[model samples]
Target: MKILVTGGAGFIASHIVDAYIQAGHEVTVLDNLVTGKKENINPKAVFYHLDIQDAQVVDIFAKHRFDLVNHHAAQMDVRRSVEDPVYDARNNVLGMLNILQACVKTGVQRFIFASSGGAVYGEQVTFPADERHQTQPYSPYGITKLVGEKYLFFYALTYQLGYTILRYANVYGPRQNPHGEAGVVAIFCRRLLDGQQPIIFGNGEQTRDFVYVKDVVTANVKALDRKDNEILNIGTSTETTINEVYEHLNALIGAGMAQKHGPAKEGEQFRSVIDYGYAKKVLDWQPQYDLQTGLKETVAYFQ
Candidate 1:
């Protein structure tokens, strides 16, 4: 199968690109390098240095006649989305529409979307939100993700396009950008490595579900053969506090840095976890890496 992986130069999608290539699939990568780095791109995959909203994307679709579009590109910063929603909408919403249009025009069969479990469910009514959980996205970034899912649904209904929406937990592993507002694991690792104190927002009791990037790639690989139009949560269904994460990383790195707490960012979810039961049942997938092991690998990558 020929696959076009948008944001394939970023942390998560890059791993997926490699996995797709290893599985003997032809792969093409599209990344604007806005947040994605060129080094993260797999050498085996055809590379396109263009934004998703570019009209030339249609040309690529025409040329490649891709079978699957694994979309991971977006304005992913939550704070930035709050600051300038127009920009976020332009990139996340409009950009995706352009890709969808091209998919429709060129007869692409399936779309595997990277949605957010943490943001989409907001402050969750349940401890571990499932696909059936009510979606009341708190931030504009979350809203955009939900919008993307809805758009995929519309395309599936009207155009008979198959899609799998993977609402991911906080994915962390090697190649995760440490400089960003997102990717807390990477940020903590980088700061500790640099002999700087890692700052924890609020009292550091806030928890999140962290899934390894490799596990996410596995879900993408499984999505290719799945014909069912499904929305699945890709997470461990377990919560780990920010302080606990810091302690784990600190132990792995032996940085011995003291925990630093700062004012919690407004609109931040106090606790976020998602159920991956549907994913396991449908895709035969479960997270292979526990927090301690995953963090050790991450620390090794940064070392």
Candidate 2:
């Protein structure tokens, strides 16, 4: 199968490309390298430095006949979205529409999207948020993701386009940028390695469901085989607090690091967790790596 992965040079998409290539599929990566790194692109896969919003993107679709399109490109930072919503919306909402337009025009069969479980559900009082949970996005980033899913649903129902929306939890692992708003794990790991104290917004007790990138890759690969066209939550279904995460990383780094408290950022959620029962039943997928194992691997990579 010929697969096209948008933002293929990114942390999560790079890993997805790895899985696709290992499965003996022909992969083409379409990325502008804006937030994505060139070093992350797999040598085996064909690369095109193109933004998802470019008009020329449609031309590429007319040229290459892609069987699957894994859409991962977006303005992912919640804080940035809050600050410059129009800018963020143009990139994520309009950008996704451009890709979907190409997909429809090119007759692409399957689309696998990287949706955010973190922001889409907002601050769920519940521990495990399922697909059936109420979607009231607190941030523009989350709103755009939800809007993309709605568009995807419409495309599927109207145009017969098959898609799998994977709502991912807080994912961390190798190649993750510590600079991004969502890369708390990577940021904490790097800080701990440097013997710097990590800062936590509000209380250090803010909890999030952490899923490993490798496990995310597994879910992506499995989506290739499944014919389902539903939104699935990809997570461990366990909440880990910010302070606990710090301790875990500190332990891995062989040190104890205290966290500094700061004012909570706008559109920030206090607690988030995703229920994976639907994913397990539908995709026959479950998380394979725990925080300890994944942290050890991620720490080694940073070291």
lDDT of 1 by residue, 192-293 (tens): 999998889999999999999888999999999975789999999999999999999888888988899999999898999999999999899999999988
Error of 1 at 88 (Å): 0.6
Clash totals in order: 0, 0
**lDDT for each residue of candidate 2 in 150-245, tens digit (9 for 90 to 100):** 999999998888999999999999999987767998998888888887888888787889999999999999999754688999999999998888
* Worst ten in a row by lDDT for model 2: 258-267
Leading candidate by TM-score: 1
Estimated TM-score for each candidate: 0.99, 0.97
Per-candidate RMSD vs. true structure? Answer: 0.7, 1.1
Model 2 stretches astray by more than 4 angstroms: none
What is the Å distance of residue 51 in model 2 from its true position?
0.7
Against the true structure, candidate 2 has what lDDT? 0.90
